[model samples]
Target: QADVLARATTWRDRLGADTPRVAIATDIEQAATLELLAGVMLAGGSVVAERPAPTTARWQRWAAERVTTVVGDPDVARGAPDAVTVLDLDGSTSPRQV
Candidate 1:
């Protein structure tokens, strides 16, 4: 517990006061997916743990949540507009920018 707290404090200090918002929105909870979400958060961002269904209500909720990035299966954000950024988890070195 002490070590964990120490590391958390160290990271907070390293990231500084103004942590940029990465907004990692995803439904899948695989190791890579979780890693991405955690990475973004640790780097001063957010994680929206939800799946994409392309429904009006879901869209509104996403908008309200200010989700800027979707990371998961391609079908997750299949019909998303070009304005919305999507990252594919296709076993690549990094998230595939789409």
Candidate 2:
């Protein structure tokens, strides 16, 4: 949707100017994921893919990187760094008419 893209652009400007490093966790094919990835790239931040089946060790590794922001399901990010801010994008309804 144009509106969503516009909003994403604004977010990109607000967050991208500094080129902060960001971590993304979601299916790359999903629309929201694509939008977020684009935003992160536009913001000049490195996008690291979070493993769906992340282990404690993996989370620790991510935490060690000091990722300041994360965009993904809150439930999946529970064990990540407490200082990391998470943006949840699970409220969108499915487009399937059925």
Candidate 3:
């Protein structure tokens, strides 16, 4: 609970009321995702996620349900307008943005 409190305080300080709805799309499993999710919520944001899917449609549904802001691999940071922010944790390279 201490960790949660600290994270929430930090989030309130950084974001104020501009809490973001986030989604993480990656191969990362649920257990591994909790820490990150907690961080987001603590910051007054929300998170939606699922295992990497074979189709974008599936991911799209999840994004819609959670109102995600970003979607990408698990190693790098990617930005999205509607979600909290995406991070790729596997250290993989993303395609060119253009």
User: RMSD per prediction, one decimal?
Assistant: 6.2, 7.0, 5.7
The true-versus-predicted C-alpha distance at residue 29 of model 2, in Å, is: 1.6
User: How much lDDT does each candidate structure score?
Assistant: 0.50, 0.61, 0.49
Whole-model lDDT for model 1 versus the true structure?
0.50
**90 Cα displacement, candidate 1 (Å):** 4.3
Most TM-score-accurate candidate: 2
Off by over 4 Å in 3: 1-17, 28-32, 51-68, 71-84, 90-98
**Global local distance difference test of model 3:** 0.49
> Candidate 1 versus the native: TM-score?
0.52
Candidate 3, 12-77: lDDT as tens digits: 344334676655665446543445556566667766555555666554565467553443463323
* Candidate 2 per-residue lDDT over residues 5-87, each given as its tens digit: 77567657645467756676556678776667666777777776666444556567677666766665555465665555566
Clashes of 1: 0
* Candidate 1: tens digits of C-alpha lDDT, residues 1-95: 45544544543343334543333444455555545544555667666646556655554667777665565555545445555555554322233
Which regions of candidate 1 fall more than 4 Å away from where they truly are? 1-29, 51-56, 90-98
- The TM-scores of all predictions, comma-separated, are 0.52, 0.65, 0.43
Residue 61: error of model 1 in Å? Answer: 1.1
**Candidates ranked by lDDT, best first?**
2, 1, 3
